[model samples]
Target chain A: MQKIFSYSNTMILLLLVLCAAVFYLTGEMSSGAELFPRITAFGLAFFGIVELILSLSRKDSMEKPIKKENNQHLVRKSVLYMLVFFLLVIFFFLCFPLIGFEVSAIGFMLIAMVLLGGRKTLRLWPVAILIPLLLVLVFRGGLDVRLPTLFF
Target chain B: MELFGAVLNLLKPLTFLAMSVGVGWGIICGALPGLGATIGIALLIPFTFGMSPLVALPMLAGVYAGAIYGGGITAVLLGVPGTSADAATVYDGYPLAQKGLANKGLTTSVSASAFGGMFSALILLFLAPPLAKASLAFGPPEYFLVAIFGLTIIAALSTSSIIKGIMAGFLGLLLGTIGIDPIVGDMRFTFGAVYLYDGFPLVPLILGLFAFPRCMVLIEDLVRKGSSQISLNLDDGGGPKLTWRETWQMKRTYFRSAFLGTLIGILPGAGANIACFVGYASAKRASKKPELFGTGIPEGVAASEAANNGTCNGSLVPLLTLSIPGSPTAAVILGALMIHGLVPGADLFTKHAEVTYTFIVSAFFCNIIMLVMGWYGSKWFGKIVQVPTYILAPAMLLVSLVGAFTVRQYTFDIGVTIGIGTAAYFLSRAGFPMASILLGAILGPMAEAGFRRAMLIGQNDLTIFLTRPLSLALVILTLASVFAGWRMQKKSKPMKDALSGKKETQ
Candidate 1:
């Protein structure tokens, strides 16, 4: 049963459902406005259904496991690292408006570096501190594009 | 001649500086894993806002040309491809490096890349103007069909599964229909968000789709590998150079691959990644001793490198002439063109000939600059692969997010980038091709506008597309492209399976 519902097939199913929702939402739009969206939705749904069917019928529907028994710890660590990175990004974005770009970016960089196994190196400290400052100078001072800095 | 005038423009101090910086930066970015030509150009687009089109467009072109060549450096030194375009180069390049012939491989790559790039630049210089002139005759129906044709070709060829590829393209089309309708001005799917009113901003979307996911992957790799430092035993000393006789011997391979690459590049949706493989495969077939092809040979490196870089300017032909981007990098360039208030097609040749010609002429000098820099800097570039993934990944994300913010000065745009990027990462993991989505998004408005206008012109006559010769021809071509893509997928299945099997074993 797990083999029958592969990742690709699941994605196709989700896309098909999204297409149906899109098709349903177009009812509020004018016929002239909805024409293209409806057609696109129809096309998406059709192909998605075909893909789902094809994927389900294949004998090798399940992707071959490339992971070795010994690599489980490594794989788990990689996923954890990815989650930490994603959370750090979210935290950076959330903090940007509150604390400002320079402080938030530098903080994000330092924490990310440490979390991603850069704590052992002396270079990480300077890199985390200097990159944001350099970027501030380049973007705000050089390019004249305003960044969200707390102080001028 | 305008060509001469364009050359003169490129020689200006500022323009020349911009071109050199773009090329050098492009090389660094391309040599780094998880950052390729698409992200390189996307990250640079924000900075181009303050420059004149003359400086901006030429610089982007230089980056495009240089990055394609730069990927070969890492391919030779490391088994990992810096960019997908360099994947084919890895077959011979890594073997050569293993045999202590890294210098010879690097030199062959630089020379071949330069030659192919210059050849295609010449072709673009001559071919684009006539094509632009011809495109002037196209009506809305023709444009509609052309957009359809582009979408179909992109969908069919981008992935192994035609169904999946087309679905991805249609998904792009659906995403593209989110904003107000072109003809009626009715908000179709804005859902009350004001940022959604203008549709998804191109810069953030590009960065999100192409850049963020790569950064994430780099972080993942860092965790799995458990080492920031790559053990390097590179032979930096001058080993053996490719003599004139050796270069002359491979001249046929260079020319044939370049020609094939250029033709593929001129086609909408095809890109350097595909061209490199095709070029390498054809060279293998034609080689007198095919069995010796991937055994650390200069000819194999030359074939793949030349074809990929040949696509640098070749992909710009359709972009400069028809307003259709031939590849993902070209799509980003198209966004840059729009940002600079330059439209594609006939006006690019007439009203903006100076800018257009300067951009084209810059490609020639870009190749020369790349050749010189790559020759001298290959050793340094090889070391770039050793940069800590922890630092590199976070830095890229920070810069990309900030760049996204600078696009419209809207903080909301940053969120957009993150969201789209997250979704794109998952989708890609599920075997969806990002290129198809990008093409669909870029071509969606064009397709819709053309379709609506043509309908109005024909008073709702569906057969209006069939009435015109060009429109009918485009329709046939679209179908033929789909058929070809299907056939190619069927033919390439064995190869793909073999390659995947090899990877699993490794």
Candidate 2:
């Protein structure tokens, strides 16, 4: 496998130049906002490049040998958990208008908790249900904002 | 004289009560592992939604001040370090606790925190107008430079490699850029998900990056070790007390650390965690017994605690005077200010003089509350560590859900929270600094809006960015910081290598 950029200054520099280009082309570069991102990008790139050069030139290595983590299983589990969360979110967005925000949100949380290895399903049930129900009541009922109810 | 009246008026019963609640809550949450002052303020924001900004702001500010001091409790007692800001305290604090001097460590922390909070509040009250003028001189380009200057402190933070730390910061910035382009309204990395329109929700992302991942990792450890059975016998009480002799002995260190912390806090993007470590290190080097630093000395505790609390004061100077938030907690406070329809800037002083004075006086009030509550609640706060991770995890998750939903009453925001939380977790594990990412996310839209407006004023000429003296000086400072950081890292590498080798050989 080809080694990707190790988040050095060069990559940062490239990102800044890209941002600058994007800002310039979008005709938004004239704003003071463009200046901050541009300057940040430029400075980050410069420092990163210098560091990269310094590492190449130095005879003695200063970095400690990388001790890679032996948690690929954990990483995999987390990644899978997140993917399930993403899909659940997508499903909730679709179901919200039909089923209502409170119900969908509750369902989303319960599923997400279970997928993320939430043990003690009994404990999870009340939290997953009650929290979203309280929010809809507080924000919609108390604040009196129009929320997506099935009939409304 | 006007300031004196402002201070006197703040001593009213209502203001004192608000200050106590804020500080008391701040310390309690701050003492919790994976929670900090920012979360403390974020959580309380909902409760304060009904109150007037005058009452609400001080109440929240009290929490901000209290939490920074409170974090030292966990650092000393459990070796957990409570919030990330108190991580430096662990060096001396845990050792002190082991030596059965936990009360002394706790006392020193409270005293230093109070001193630092008072010092910074004084600075804010008297010197804020002049500093506000200085802050106003900064344009977008200058703020961008300030952001870089903030990131340069990563060198001080990096114990492993400068390369790794810089990588983490840059990746964080990139992560900050992941959402829709603020100027163009085009999504960059959302992968066709409509929920990511606002990029990441700050509270949940932070909670996930700092809290969630830590909780997940700790679960395995807790299971393996079986949770440590440490109980706080609340009756074994050493009440709130600090000796003048002890204060005088550490006065110089306290002042120096507070000054250093305040200065760093004034700079955008940096936080109290960075300040505490810097203060602790500088104190150790200057101490008579530099070798005795990690052995639970009062000076080290004073340095860390003072620096941490000093940051709270320093951060507000910019937020109130210039509308620029120095840290995430300050940023959340800015949101709270906006929620109350208060825009921070030059007008903040003249237009809302009473409110402003009330806020300033509240700082002093909050500091006193921190001392009082930290003493009274120390034993109570210590019991929180015994709560199971399983319970705390879901509770936090539930809070994050509500926090997101409450913001706009949009389920979309809650969805955004989960997405942002998930992405933030990955970004953090991949070695990105969540703080920088947050800075970028929060400040990106501002910079974009400002830069575009400035360009229209100058007919799109890039030279205008440098033509302004404030912008030019900021550029120079930013350059100097980057160069200085690189040089510092280069110089420190060999010493670090030597130290590690010495340990290995022993």
Candidate 3:
């Protein structure tokens, strides 16, 4: 056998399990309010089951080994890049209210660009500096949206 | 006449200034790969609270119209589509660019978009009330069926796989249940978090499903082929220039696709992407030289451009007449209206007639401005695709994060956005349609409310849906749609494969 399950089948199974678990955990509530959740969960599980069953009929082929290997480097790099991005975003989120939009905005943009492309993107200096300032001017100055503040 | 008066009132300097700014921002957003109109509207919702309905509606509508049209530039000049709706445009548009007929492709696209936008707007103006009047007789059971009809059509036509699309939609409905119950204030899946009480905010969910997934795709492209630049040369422009004659020649394609787009937009769950696909496919099928499609053909550009742009007004039909958003971005627009203390539906036509008429009328003028902007600015807007990934990625992420934060001014919303975005990335890789998921989320509340209302009205009798004529008809339509989708898949297997092969090679 190529595997116990295909990748999609595994995800479908996982989703089915989540549905069952969520439905079971709902306990007893006003029947009407719970009705939508119950119906949707049940429906999702039904489709998941169908997907799982259909996935079994698919035969995995080891075709195009060279192409797969060639793609490995790019896929790995891209995954790493995304992880780094989200981590930076999370840090920005954490520091947002405390350090304020102005500081975090500049830091986030500069750090993220450097991480993604090194110093080759120094040419983007103007755009990098201007965008966040423009956002502040529009949201804070023009619209009077109250951002978490450090400096006026 | 009242609508004309409302339009005239919006001719003031302040209105034009606001609209110009909004349209300019929208064009820039639509030209960028990861940023689309939904985020544009989401960020603007909070800001619109400060402006009058007259000023706000025109500005938002201008943004809406401009964003839809602006996508044509990148689709023509670069192989990359500015928006998903413009993906079909990339098929013909990019080929024209490679042949140095970029101006022709760009002009055809802009003109098609303008025609489609104007046609759909006229339909909305003339057809909304009658279409809505037909729904006035509809009650709880019919409402449930209407929601079900939306889900069924999405499930059937949105993806290559019917079951997967339905599952994706169902997953959205499940997420929609995360907040407080509409009928009874009990929280089902809040898991003891105060944030869950309001459910997942639509902005976060939309970004997660629609916007963030693109980031993942961008990452793959960036990694596989490091950032690339567009090759531009106006002196070497070798292909036939677009003429008024060619524009008129494609009028048949324009009308058919425009009508198709508008009708699809009127359907609750349908959006611009689906409209473009159908329009392009139908255009190819109806062509004498269908073989010429995707070969930098003007007909191909016309179909996609018109259909995708047509959906703007097509979607407004249900949004204005019924208060049900016809697309995800339209849902964001609905939020804008809500903040301004204006509810859609019959009340808008009566109590807020001025605002309603102005909003509808403003869409017409917005399209005109969009046409002019797209025609003149194509050369500049088309250059946006050449930006380095490192630069584009950070800018898009920062703007998106900031927009997400501004909505509720909460960090938790950002978490939700990122989490959902990650899930959407994986789901898309696994072949689930994100549009279906978005539709599910948007339609969930309406479906739930309708079901609950039906139960209360019918005293727990499930037969009420079957007993009501409109509901029963809708139920049949839903089933028919599913069957039609099955047949379409089976019949088009060879054609679809052939088309994809041709598209890739060209």
Candidate 4:
């Protein structure tokens, strides 16, 4: 057990902690609402503990090595870019209710395109602008699906 | 007869137009790397919100059938399987391409795919109603067990460790418990957020799991290589198309593989890739010249195509019959049905026969269209592989954001979706089965509702699940599936360890 703790299965440990926190939060709920959550929490804890024990018992199970070839699994990129994409998305949606849909979406697309390495071409601006405009037309005019719009 | 006519009447210009366009777009998406039936269907689901069931369902069916066949295009020409469903094709297909038989590989694959797709559709048309009728007898305890059965199948079929899959599933179920309780009005896990009242929206959750992750992946690819595009030799004009005589020779291979695929697909948790590989192995075992399978053979391509496409409709059988999705794609379809206020079950067949019949009938036509379009559209489809990731990534990001927001016309869902997508990306990297997470979330609510109702009725008797015949059978099946899967993994691990250079256990 001491040896098990010496090797860090960091992600699994994090997940276990998260599970515990979620389970503890469920304590605040009414009994009617808490039943299913409690069941799921119990499941989460049970499987997590079992997996930890198994992971610990395996040979050199500390942290699994990454596959170099599988792009679907491990991505080779800087944390800064990942943070940029995440923050860009978070910021755009945060400003959405204030600025409405078209303005925010179009702005989000243009900025994200530049940030994500879309080439600077004459076609870029038109595409970034037109997709949202065309979407507004099809969904709003044709489908009557409401999208938040601003006067600007 | 009128119902048949009504079903056939989906041949209207609008529906036909939608089918062709959907199939064409699906072929393009599928021919591209990292885009498959799941992403294609998820991206298109938003567009279906405005259209009638007749318009929308046919379009979806077209995408489903066409995207799968489209995957074979990349596997043969580029040596990259467009989807995991097409992975089996790559072994034999790339070899054929190298031997200057790209045309034949493409032809055999498309033809076999069309055959397999149509065969499964016929089975769905003929077989679904009776199965749905049988499902009418399922009580709450049975439904609960059915969900368990589906989860077990997933756990069994997980390529990674079963424990990790179950843990991911548990995490998903735990996430599902965030909204108002089914039995009572009180909220659980809301944490004072108004958005939590409706629970996590399906659109955001799905987009986060499947779509957004791909977008981020595309961005990562762009940064890694300054926007890379798929390049292939289009100079050969693809050698020669397969003759009818050659196709006729492979008839047994096609039918047997399709049957195997459909049977596997009918079982919960066995996805198209599993069907593809099993069919490939079966075809090899039954072959007169099994040695030639990986050496550029038409039989290999045909078997791979037939099985993968066969699973397309086979996976739908359980979804249409019992609300238990047979695969991840079927899970998305289940979500679509629920979104449209059309739950899958007995009522889907009897109450909404017009929509249900029309949906199944459309799949038949979609297969025919896939054959027509796939055979002729190979040249244009190949060009889509060359499109740069930078442009595609931004477009997909915008679409995913819009898709999540428009589903309920809430901007909060967009934030929620991106958050889930980021977390899902990390989880996937950690060797968790992402699809297991998806399946768990989809089935969690049903399991909870059934469990609660069964409890209320049985006065908290857990034996109600065991007492009912159908439920008991399902319980046995689930346990057997998990055990068999565990045993199979244990058996395979030694071989896997010996084969792999760097063994990573999760």
Which residue window of length 10 is worst by lDDT in model 4 chain B? Answer: B497-506
**Model 3 per-residue lDDT tens digits across residues B146-252:** 76766666666544577887888799888878888888787778788887788777667766665566655666667767876666534565356679888788989
Question: Which docking band does candidate 2 fall into?
Answer: incorrect
lDDT tens per residue, model 2, A7-51: 333344454565555445435334332343445455456655666
Candidate 2 C-alpha lDDT tens digits along B236-269: 4533345779889998999999998888787754
Q: What is the interface RMSD of each candidate, in Å?
A: 1.4, 6.2, 2.0, 3.0
**Model 2 chain B: which ten-residue window has the lowest total lDDT?**
B497-506
Residue A87 displacement in candidate 2 (angstroms): 6.0
Pitting candidate 1 against candidate 2, the one with the higher DockQ is: 1
- Candidate 3, position B301, lDDT: 91
Ranking by DockQ: 1, 3, 4, 2
Per-residue accuracy of model 1 over B281-342 as CA lDDT, tens digit each:
99999999999988989999999998998888998998888777777678778778877878
Q: Give the CAPRI class of candidate 3.
A: medium
Model 2 alpha-carbon drift over 4 Å, by segment:
A5-152, B1-18, B43-51, B135-253, B267-271, B281-293, B318-344, B487-506
**What is the DockQ for all candidates, taken in turn?**
0.74, 0.17, 0.60, 0.51
TM-score of chain B of each: 0.93, 0.79, 0.84, 0.93
lDDT against the true structure, per candidate, is: 0.83, 0.66, 0.75, 0.80
Off by over 4 Å in 3: A1-5, A28-32, A59-69, B33-53, B79-101, B233-304, B322-344, B490-506
lDDT of 2 at B187: 59
Candidate 2: what lDDT? 0.66
